[model samples]
Target: MSKYKLFLLRHGEGAWNKENRFCSWVDQKLSEDGVKEAQDCGRLLKEQGYKFDLVFTSILSRSIQTAWLVLEAMGQEWVPVVKSWRLNERHYGSLIGLNRAEMAQQHGEEKVKLWRRSYDITPPLIDESHPYFLEIYNDRRYTTCDVPIKDLPRAESLKEVLDRLLPYWNSTVVPEIRNGRTVLISAHGNSCRALLKYLEGISDEDIASVTLPTGIPVLLELDENLKPVKPRQLLGDQAKIQAAIKKVEDQGKAKPST
Candidate 1:
């Protein structure tokens, strides 16, 4: 049991999350409630006696902050944190600031759903002239990485995300897992999906139905072959987790508030 702990956590809610906006790559801070949720997540992991060997998070601040909160609660803030853009929330392209409800209204529910949920369908690209482009595009940290900066991606499908993420997973994460160390990851929704889809071998059609609620820690114990010993388990109240998942699934609806 000591050799197989893998904890995957999505970041707590951001300001845009509360407002129902498409928040990819926007790098917003956690909301007040989000901070509390993250703290609670840390408390839960500490109660479960999770001591991590290493932590990984997206370059985005929200995910990084969640990792910090979780580690602090565990009294293991000293654990090393590795940051990577590969773990970023999927790029929302031209839809970055639009409310999901408005997007569904403009693009129609089905197209919006396909864009949001499909494995390979990329969203409409954001025009470089879109004022937001300069911030992430010109960011020095990403540009200097070994990953080609020109291909940093203005739009990304889940498949594209998985493609980019797998290299890091294979190159970095797999070795640590093979070394029998417990690992923790704090990441975004779509990035977590990429990991889940790969780990569980989920079908593309079925992957569309998957949703990750903010601030829950998902535990997976792998056998020697790296297959899950049992189904993934979510920590915390089951009813609340289900409700949160429902809320996430509802986020793409044309009438999101319904």
Candidate 2:
């Protein structure tokens, strides 16, 4: 009856997050508040006597930065860390640099919501004509990806994110958990949600309602079969966590004009 521990965290607020933009895979860095949030998360986990044996993060700088801050705060900077493109944020495609609120205003809130939160409805694709296409495709990090640059996603739904992420989960992450290692995964919002959908066996419709607050650690105790023993615990101040959740939930809403 061994119970294994796992921690899932969305990287703290990024510059685009503060501006309510579709960050997708554009590689924005963490905001100042994001830096503090990551540090605080680390300190909080340290206070709870949590130490990670292995850490996984997307190849994106923001995700890597959050993981670094968290480990440093816990004085576990020496933990083994692995980076993978599979854990990167959902590819926002043509919507990459657009403002979320503005998109909502232009397309109607419901349409924007469907694009952002739906399980299978992908946003528009990013082709060679899109502004960021060359920059993204030419990035050195992607050159090392498991698949060719041409094969990477231009647009993806929540289901697509899960599709790309599952292989890594089964091949890399699950085995470590079975070995009794305390694992931490630092990832993007949609990426985290995608993984949760798989781990919790959430239906497509039910998954849309799940919004993760940035920087909060979701701790789960899993049975030998990798099923959660009970409800997952989100570590942090409840009020702040609620507010953060609201912020994420509101990102797709049209902002009232002055």
Candidate 3:
């Protein structure tokens, strides 16, 4: 029996990520450090003799840009790439452009934590008056989505993100993997977490504390039955990966007073 490989990557830091803001669907590009992070991930994968047969990414620029950088580094720029909105970060809704630390300060760390980390708790819905509402809803990328514009989510819980992502995973991604192709999925933190929850059978409460560091590749070897052969492996420096995860966990905390 042959084993198939799958790689999941959370896109590198975005401009909004550096500012500790909720980027969700605002299409922010990767920051300077983010660019380097993507390149470094590619170099690491290259050093390990990995080559992808297919790539998938969210429509968000950060995710797409990370895919591009990684492919460029791997010298596999010609690989077929698929883009889907279902893989987008969980929509932050009214919190889209707001700073996470400031929100934590105003709403109390506990409440903000619920919004950010709870499986079923969703943030407030985005209203028409929000600054980026029109820009995001009217974007061309969304025009091609399977659902009508009005049907797109204004806010979503982690469960909702997984619900939306599963259709794409089952219909498109699974087929490719079963066909014996090596796959790479470049997506956002919440989206990747959603998929991980499904793949690993993690409990909802346990999934909340799982933080994926940006730009590192998560390697999984799947048996012919599509089950993991062993524990998933994260490629790159383990110490740095832990520190990056700590950074992600701290983003929702209130900044200490001067």
Work out how many backbone clashes candidate 1 has. Answer: 0
Off by over 4 Å in 2: 256-258
Error of 3 at 8 (Å): 0.3
lDDT of 2 by residue, 1-258 (tens): 438989999998899898888888898999999999999999999999999999999999999999999999999999999999999999988999998889889999999889988999998999999888888899999999999998999999999999999999999999999998999999999999999888888999999899998899999888899998788789989998899889889988899532
Q: TM-score each candidate.
A: 0.95, 0.98, 0.97
The residue ranges of model 3 lying beyond 4 angstroms of the native Cα positions read 256-258
Model 3 weakest lDDT span, ten residues long = 249-258
> Taking the tens digit of each residue's C-alpha lDDT, what string does model 3 give over 99-185?
888988998999888999999998999999999999999899899999999999999999999999999999999999998889999
Can you rank all candidates by lDDT, best first?
A: 3, 2, 1
| TM-score, cand. 1 vs. native | 0.95
lDDT of 1 at 209: 92
- Estimate every model's Cα lDDT from 0 to 1: 0.89, 0.92, 0.93
